[model samples]
Target: MMLIDGKKVSTDLKNELKTRVEELKAKAGCVPGLTVIIVGEDPASQVYVRNKAKSCKETGMNSTVIELPAETSQKELLGKIEALNQDPDVHGILVQQPLPSHIEEYAVTMAIDPSKDVDGFHPENVGQMVLGNLDKCFISCTPFGILELLRRYDIETRGKHCVVVGRSNIVGKPMANLMLQKLRETNCTVTVCHSATQNMPELTRQADILIAAIGRANFITREMVKPGAVVIDVGINRIEDPSRKSGFRLAGDVDFDNVAKMTSAITPVPGGVGPMTIAMLLKNTLQSFARSHNL
Candidate 1:
């Protein structure tokens, strides 16, 4: 089975973006800038934000990170977003998730300008994506990265049965919509299975391409996959592993060891969809930059 190496693919895409950044810099006399507002001291979010800034610098883009206390008020956060929205140098604005319990996530989503909504959670961008107007939308990074992986690996999806095993807005819903669109690289017959889905395995076994995004450890077993199917594992869960130095291991929704034997190709946990998410964030920021300058 062919392993879908997200690390290698992400590196290649970043290198290409680096060159594009140089071209844009030479023409525009400035580089694109991304501003990320992070609230609280969530360890995971901190790591992700650091990686994003590093990637931005690698691509010759400017990165700004605003660290806020856990007790920061919602009004203060929204005001910060508004200020960034008016900042011409900040091409993209992203506020990290899981704010303090008092803060409403939806309000934060609505605060960012649609043009600068690199995370693609704004209602305007979502509307454009739902209408198949991808040119005007910044799709959620994970779903966008999955499509890029399929394209880069030359996987055929036209009219093929694709099963998405989740319903989360970040990955599943957008992925299904992307596959349903009449695009050359997508255009798959999609079936989405969630907690409400009946006979899940029976439905999943019929797919030619399977997307596993359920937030569970090894939820998709060998029996659920069709032979020769292409599997994209989007789940990342930490499971107890006494054998490991960290006493835990990262696993995807699919049982990689058993499921890989059934699929023609599959993505491994930690090195699969994870890396591509950051790469696509960089891409979306770059796109915002290009549009700002009408490039």
Candidate 2:
């Protein structure tokens, strides 16, 4: 069995983006700028935003973080988004997700201008993606990253049976759409399964490529996966574990130890899809800048 090393792939992608950004800078006299908004002090959200900012700096792009207090009103947050949208210097806008329970997530997503919505959660961008006009909108980071990994490894999806477990806008829905697109490597027959799906195991077992994005840990076991299939784990769940120093451990939806033995290729939790998500965010930011400037 071969392990899909996402860390290595993300590094290569970042290097390629860095070189391209340098060329754009030399020729166009500008580098991309990404603005991230973080509301409240969620530890996990803070780490994610910090990683995004660090990536932007590494790629020679401008990074801005707008920190808001936990008690900040929704109106205030929307105002901040509006300011960033009008700021010509900001090429991409990403609002860190899972905002405090009181805040409406969809409202914040809609507040971001479509052109600067690098997170690709805006209605306009999502519509463009559903229409297969990627040139007109930024695709969601995680789904785009999945396609990148498949392309880098030369995994052929054409006419293959691809099963994606989850229906969230961020990962599963777009992933299914991308795989079924009329493209050479992505012309797969796609099936999307959610919590309401009956006989879920039977559906998953028929897959030539299985993508698990359900937010539950160890949800996909060896029995659910077909032998010699390629598995991509998109779920990142934190479980309490007293044995660990942090009193918790990170795990994917798949039971990796057993599933790894059955699958021809699999992505490990910490080193897999996680890194690629951030890399793709940087890529989208660069693309947004280029589009805004007509470069």
Candidate 3:
């Protein structure tokens, strides 16, 4: 089975974005800018925010990270978001997730301006997706990256049976929505399986393209995969491993070792979908800049 190299695809996308940023700077006297706000010091959230900031700089764009304390009040955080919303220099605004227990996510998600909501979590952006107005709103990064991978690989999605195993707003739902769109890069028959799905394997075995985003380690086994089907594993679960210096290893939703034997192509855990998410975020930021500047 051939491996779907997400790292390479993301690198290519970043290079293109870098050039675009240069063109914007030369023509408009400014480059795209992204601002990330992290409420708590969750280790994973911190790492994600740091990487986003670094990527912004690498792509020749302006980057800013606002680190708030765990006890920061909701009003305080919302105030910060409003300030970023009005900042002309900031083309994209993202709030790193998993806030402290006292902070309600719904409020924070709604606070960001839809035009600058690069994370695509705002209802306004989601409404555009529901209406199939793909050009008018930002798509959540993971699903967008999956589509890019399929398009780059010349995967014929038209009329294909694409199964998405997850229902989270972040990945599964958007993925299913995108695959079912009447577009050349999408236009596939989609089936979504969730925790309540009965006879899940029976449904999954019928897929031409299978996407795993259940956030569980090795949840999709070989028995659930169809032979010659293309598998895209979007789950990244950390498992303890004594052999590793970090005392743990990362794994995907599918059992890559066994599932790879059944699928014609598949993506690995760490290198597969992770890099693409960041790449797409940069792309969205660039798009926002282009739209704002009429470029």
Across residues 223-258, which tens digit of lDDT does each residue of candidate 1 receive?
999999999999999999999998999999999999
State each model's CA lDDT, in order. 0.94, 0.92, 0.93
Regions more than 4 Å wrong, model 1: none
- The residue pairs in collision within model 2 are none
- The TM-score ranking, best first, is 3, 1, 2
Candidate 1 lowest-lDDT run of ten: 181-190
Error of 1 at 20 (Å): 0.3
Candidate 2 TM-score over all chains jointly = 0.98
Give the RMSD in angstroms, all C-alphas superposed, for model 3. 0.7
* CA lDDT, candidate 1, residue 86: 98
lDDT of 2 by residue, 159-262 (tens): 99999999999998999998888876588999999999999999999999999999999999989999999999999999999999999999999999989988
